[model samples]
Target: MSALFPTYKRFNLSVKQASGTTVEDTDGNTYLDFGAGIGVCNLGHRHPDVQLALENQLNQYWHVSNLYQQPIQEATAKWLIENSTGDQVFFCNSGTEANESAIKLARKATGKHKIISFKQSFHGRTFGSMAATGQEKIHTGFGPMLESFHYVPFNDRDAVKRAVDGDTAAIMMEMIQGEGGIHMADPDFVQEVAHVCRQNDVLLIIDEVQTGIGRTGKPFAYQHYDISPDIITSAKGLGGGVPIGAMMAKKTLRDAFGPGSHAATFGGNPLAMAAAQAVLKHVFQDDFLHGVTEKGRYLQERLNKSVGDLPVVSSIRGKGLMIGIECTEDVSHKISSLIDKGLLVLNAGPNVIRLLPPLIVSKQEIDVAVQLLSGVLTDEKASIT
Candidate 1:
């Protein structure tokens, strides 16, 4: 009897309000939030700085034509560029749109039609970005997909080498396959892919949609490696809860995207830009990211010690604050159990329980989440016998 489409498998709990890694249900029950709105609220729900920035913008202006002088948008773009090798940016409404723009930029800049992406990698849901996604299930009914998108095994440099050719426009990839089960790409493999693309005049597009904006203890996860991508697509945590996405490319490709080639009506609206400016100002600091890295290391160690040997747990892997716990059986029930027990978590693929806590989560919070997860997993192990 719901008016909404059946696109998502909705959760039972009604989110009435949320703040700083905590959510209150309609019935007044509170839960510690570990999912962070699928990594969109990295600074935690309605962070003070972001809230203040948005409020100030609200008192000024909310929307305007892209043709007008938008200094806020330019400032937000400068923040992204300051933390990346990219020099130019095209703003959009979401990660999908950012990725869609990346696809277009890659093809137009290189004058190539085919694209190389990794199997199990996820880009977005839009046509161009969805086509770039290598998962078959996502493309099940959307055929005939925009053609010439070749897929290869992730982390297999040999597969990538065999797949790239003259017609390849770009090789799109994720640092930690966020939606594809929290798989981490090897650093050497990433560097090699960048090398291959450079050698062939193919652009290297890094999709940092899920892992950017301080999600992985850095501005973007690609910063963990030595490779420099030709383009970077980002969103998710970029606006710290507001809707915003940006596709940044090297200055060399600026001509390809000339004013008329691409755009988004509400791409860098004042509200979104204001929110991003606050988020970037706080998260781009060295102390903040260092805290994330340390907390990530601590969380990994604690999880390994607590649940690594559990009968239901197959493995625990990932980097920074993005960790995944693979189980021997389906984790859907366990996830529900955790939700019922007052902890909000999410799944990556079928069997992996992905943990993406707010970057502002403290060590005490980490311990609490681990204990809750450990208890549920222990019970899951007992039921599997």
Candidate 2:
């Protein structure tokens, strides 16, 4: 009997410690981690730089009120602005908060109530963010959801065109739908959305909670597209495992959030800022990003070559390190089997195996994961046959 709430379908394994791309359980069993803490540990667990930064900040200060000016916050925000598309940022504690802030900003700035989101897209779990999420399952039992959110089919420009109207305040979407089975947005569709937002004077909010911070071989996944969103929400990898999320916006919207408009108690605290600074310093490097791109290609190629022929595998998709393998059968058992075999993976939806390996994963590590996955698929195919 566990004291904790039964929210998550708890895995039996207990992780005692974790390093680059591996985690050790309480019984000393080690497993290669492919989920990267659900795309939060981009630099891997306890990265030396992140650890040192946290230690240094610990010796100085930890928390402070948002009323006072904080240099660390300013520095982190500056770094974020310098590397990405936005000029201003609002820090929060998680992806959900970042998205919530974005929604509020969009609504307040435009003085409009409606927001356009796509089907199968996940923004967050909070009230506003949850409402923005187009998936119906998450909204179950949580009736009376925040209204004024319209859902259109993803990658359908015509649907988006028809969906947008005078009441729409913003267009929010994920560049690569992470939680929705790793679906990649069509370039044309993204461009069309951007065009519609601009033409209608509606804000475009890009949710980079999972695809930002070099997760997709770019500082932000939106960079892969030519479109420029008015606001971008980022979290997962920004703090390198530390809890931090930021909602960045263009200079034009700087006045959107006045002093009393929105604020977070522990948004840009010293510890989180230090961790984010270290992560930004590393991920902003050209060499590191280039390596991510290269490694992503290698991983994709290996998956295609090794498991693409397997009868159990339906398709392999996604960009950069955020890859997904769609299985013909339910992936719940497959994930558990892989975990038992010393490989930890994630399930996106019911049949898609989501893999978000740490950026620092070596070729050897990737090869090992692929081989293990191959074996699992082979056995599964045999059983089905």
Off by over 4 Å in 2: none
Score residue 39 of candidate 1 by CA lDDT.
93
lDDT of 2: 0.93
lDDT of 2 by residue, 84-199 (tens): 78999999999999999999999998899999998999999999999999999989999889989999999999999999889899999999998899999999988889999989
Tens-place lDDT digits, model 1, residues 256-341? 99978998899898899999999999999999999999999999999999999998898999888999999987889999999999
- Candidate 2, TM-score vs. the true structure? 0.99
Candidate lDDT values, in order: 0.93, 0.93
Candidate 2 local Cα displacement, residue 39, angstroms: 0.5
